[model samples]
Target: MSEQRVRGVPAQPSAPDGPTPKRLPAGGQRGGPPWMGAGMPAERSLNFGPTARRLLRRLRPQRLHLGAVIGLAVVSVGLTVIGPKVLGYATDLIFTGVIGQQLPSGTSADDAVAAARAAGNHNFADMLARMDVVPGAGIDFPALGRVLLLALGLYLAASLLMWWQGWLLTGVVQRTVFQLRAEVEEKLNRLPLPYFDRQPRGELLSRVTNDIDNISQSLQQTLSQLLTSLLTVVGVLGMMFWISPLLAVVALVAVPLSVVVTGQIAKRSQRKFIAQWTHTGELNAQIEEAFTGHDLIKVFGRRREVEAAFHAKNEQLFQASFGAQFISGIIMPAMLFIGNLSYVAIAVVGGLRVASGAMSLGDVQAFIQYSRQFTQPLTQVASMANLLQSGVASAERVFAVLDADEQIPDPAAPVRFTDPHGRVEFERVSFRYDPDKPLIEELSLVAEPGHTVAIVGPTGAGKTTLVNLIMRFYELDAGRITLDGVDITELRRDDLRGRIGMVLQDTWLFGGTIRDNIAYGRPDATEEEILAAARATFVDRFVRSLPDGYDTVIDEEGSNVSAGEKQLITIARAFLAEPALLILDEATSSVDTRTEVLLQRAMAALRSERTSFVIAHRLSTIRDADLILMMEHGRIVEQGTHEQLLAAHGPYHRLYQSQFHQAAGGDDPMPVAAASTAG
Candidate 1:
């Protein structure tokens, strides 16, 4: 689908397609292809603690709601304590009733009758025990009913509180993730250019998609179960100690052993989780690379090789994922086993105490319940450790990008150039991408206002690097470049770039109407000015012939446009910018002879009021240039007017003659000497 730009263009109409027109060879256009994802690096982490902490920091803004959710958890667990207590009281009352029915044989009939009557509670005696608790067997049925009703109320309250907690926690999780993703997107725009250079798009996307998903999974697993289990553990422990401290001590014997087991599972899972995310990124990279280069693979008859490469990456991901899950999977069963063992110990030890009259039946029951509560949270914490580690790995990656330095810092004090005279000078400038190898050394030049300077060189002769420096795409290693006698570095980067216009050999047309692409360099330009720029580049005639004219929808990278048409549109864009300095690098190299003539005319027109730098291959294009500079091996070898260079019969003369021979479709050197002597 073609994108529409909201600039100076008519509404575009759709077009049918097989292979739509474009500016260059389909895969080579810049401004980053639409198919490419945001490129950035992934996490390098095997540490869960730091990652979890960072995720928590992301949640700080929503702490108030989270606290309310935890409060609900406590209420839910409070009901758990009351439920079993009610059942125990009811059991004690039933036992008491059975015992009350009989008396000793020596007792008188009147005394026996009185004892039986006393066993049935009077109004005064019933008042001593609270109505909500199960009365002793000496009391009536209404009291037992009240105990059941109270338990029901506690159970209902717990359910209600739990529902509310789930609702709030889910909202918090979603909102927190939304904010995190938004921040990640913002950081993508702010990161330095080199960060993208070092990272793959697929891996970067994995950080945003797969990693963020892991964080959400962690939240879902940890918050709900962990909070409820923790409260249950505390409430059960409190009840246990209340009933019989001795039995409670025996039930906790499994706590230290459970801790050791849980620690081992978590430690193993941490490494596995890290490896898992790494493999996931690798797998994503392979899939992205395969899909993007499918045509190339087919052309080279490498489909089998591509599949094998894909299989290897997929297998690694599967192994890592399986290992992490396996380790994490052990945690729950280990927890259940330890809880069961603790229950058996509590049951055996407490039953003996009860039989010896040292404890009650209710106390033994409560102690076993408490043991489950203790083990449950420990189990939950163990299982969540794996998910938490995955989230941490993702968090580390996100933070790494957020913390990366921005490529261009805005100047504190900025100089702006308006109506520049375009007197550009480079003084003893040197540059290198890596410090160990220099691209250009001690390069110095001066271009006076309104003069065209053409730089000629072999491949890797630092021609493009020199142009990049002029555009300030890369900073120089030493010395400086100035425009109108003002240091370019001191100017705001945006302002510095704004005053200069550049046109490259390969032109990119964005997915938009013809007018929209042309107006990209000046959004507020009037329609008349837009058309005038198109006319200046001689593109207006072709555009007018199209069905929708200026409203024609260009395909991705202007694939629906011809190379010459795309170049014309780019030139139109530069024309709209109306800058004082124009830089054209190999601008007409891809055009046919017919289009080349039109391009030369358009370039000549644009160069009238501007200081222009032309990087040329066809010597005829620059025969009229003010000066020609020849470069080789990062150093300037010659500089003179075209006629003077031809007179010298140096490298320029030989290069000109070689091109003449190629134009004649021959390999002879006669054209070289002939052209040199004729000049």
Candidate 2:
């Protein structure tokens, strides 16, 4: 296949035989095509403590609702804790009834009670006080029924409260995530252009969408479980001690050991989780690039290369994810083992205590249940550690964007333009994209109202940089720019940019009707004004051919239309805006020759009585410009009218001859210069 052309540039040269595969970079692989692996430095090494603190700080706005959720969780857990103990009481009552039934005929109730007391069973003695028992009666069925009913009610109430807690927490999580998403979007707008230039679009997108979603999921699922587990641990420990201090001490032995084991495993898992998510983001970036650049990849026969890169990242993600999960996966079983050990200790010790008549069977049963409950929460907390770690990792990435440096701020007190006349002046301006590498230095120029100035240069000659400085997209390191004799820096950015209209080599038209796209700079444009602007830019010619005319919808980036057609629409938009100043940067470069002719005509009409700055690669387009600045390196090499520059035989003269004279198959340059001057 013939070489495929990329936008605004010539086709890329074919690769050499046996092309070397691209490798992902070190230090988490900082830059590549979005999908190959663009690592965000901030997410590489996470400080769990600080990230957690900041995440909590973000919850300050929702603290009131969070507090309420906590309260409900506590109430629910408390009710749940009480249910088992009440059931244990019912068991003791049944045992007592069986014993009463087994007593010999004519045995007195007081004699049986004395015999139970003689066995050193205080709980049995207390049960007798609460119940009216005949020596031969089997049981107090009514009392046991009531106790069982109360336990059932408590369990039901706990379930209801848990549901309510989940409901409230859902709202809190959603609202918090909503606010976080909003902040990320706002941060994107505030970040400097350089930040976006350095970061992949897909990486930033992952932070906003994927990372934030992880955090939301963690809060929704794990947070409530954490609260319940903590409360359960505390309540169970208290109940254990109430049953028998000896068994409670035995159960306490497992708490510190479980904590130590979980902590060690969690620390290792945290790093793995960070890597896992980082790799996920890298993979996301790769997918975005692959899809967006699908045509490029296919045209270049890079399917194997693309798949190889993807496979490499996919493997890395798999390994990291598996490591994290496998390490965290150890927590549940390990905690459960320790919990079982505690349970056995309690059972053995309690059995002996009951045999010695120091503890009732009912109390031993309750103590064993409490021991199981205590260990159950420990296991839950251990399981949640992985989720908490992953969430913290995601939160770290989200916060990194929020903490990025913003664009240069506006002045403390901004000035406003009044009755602007579009007289622009650049005075001794010096600027650089990086301080070490200067692009434009000590440059000065003045553009009077309603005049056309053409800036021409080879690539990297600061032609576009001049326009960027004029637009205040980047602030100058030194000197200043003025619009209509007022310092532009002092004016509000909106006020300064509002008066200028720009149409670039790359035209931008959002998904909208042709009319809407044309009226983008002037949304309030009337139908007649829109039609007139379209006609002026020759955009109506094609719009009329369309089935829906001006109302036809275009796809995003205006892909539904031809490139030339998109350019004409953008030109029409500038025409409708009717700004005091206009900037056309290689505006005719992408169109075909015929379209270029029509565009040049339309542009001539638009330039009438308007201050215009035209940056062009085709020297023929700006032959009639009133003032031409020929640039090389970072400064203007020559400045003159077209005929005068040709007469002078300077840098502009040499450039014109090399382009036009060679293209015309003429070696002699003087005659062409003479003919141009005569014309």
Error of 1 at 180 (Å): 3.6
Poorest 10 consecutive residues by lDDT, candidate 1 = 9-18
Task: Judge candidate 2 against the unseen true structure and give its global Cα lDDT, from 0 to 1.
Answer: 0.79
TM-score of each candidate structure, all chains considered together: 0.79, 0.89
- Global fold similarity of model 1 (TM-score): 0.79
Question: Which 10-residue span in candidate 2 carries the lowest summed lDDT?
Answer: 1-10
Q: Put down candidate 1 lDDT per residue, 144-237, tens digits, no spaces.
A: 6787788788889989999999999999999999998888777775553334544556767888888888788878778788788778878877
Poorly placed runs, candidate 1 (over 4 Å): 1-45, 76-149, 170-175, 353-367, 504-515, 538-568, 588-591, 617-624, 665-679
- For residues 286-396, what per-residue lDDT tens digits would candidate 2 score against the true structure? 888788789899999999998998898888889899999999999999999999988888899988786665776678888888888889988988998889899999998
Backbone N/Cα/C clashes per model: 5, 3
If candidate 2 were superposed on the true structure by all CA atoms, what would the RMSD be? 6.6
Clashing pairs in 2: 34-285, 35-285, 35-286
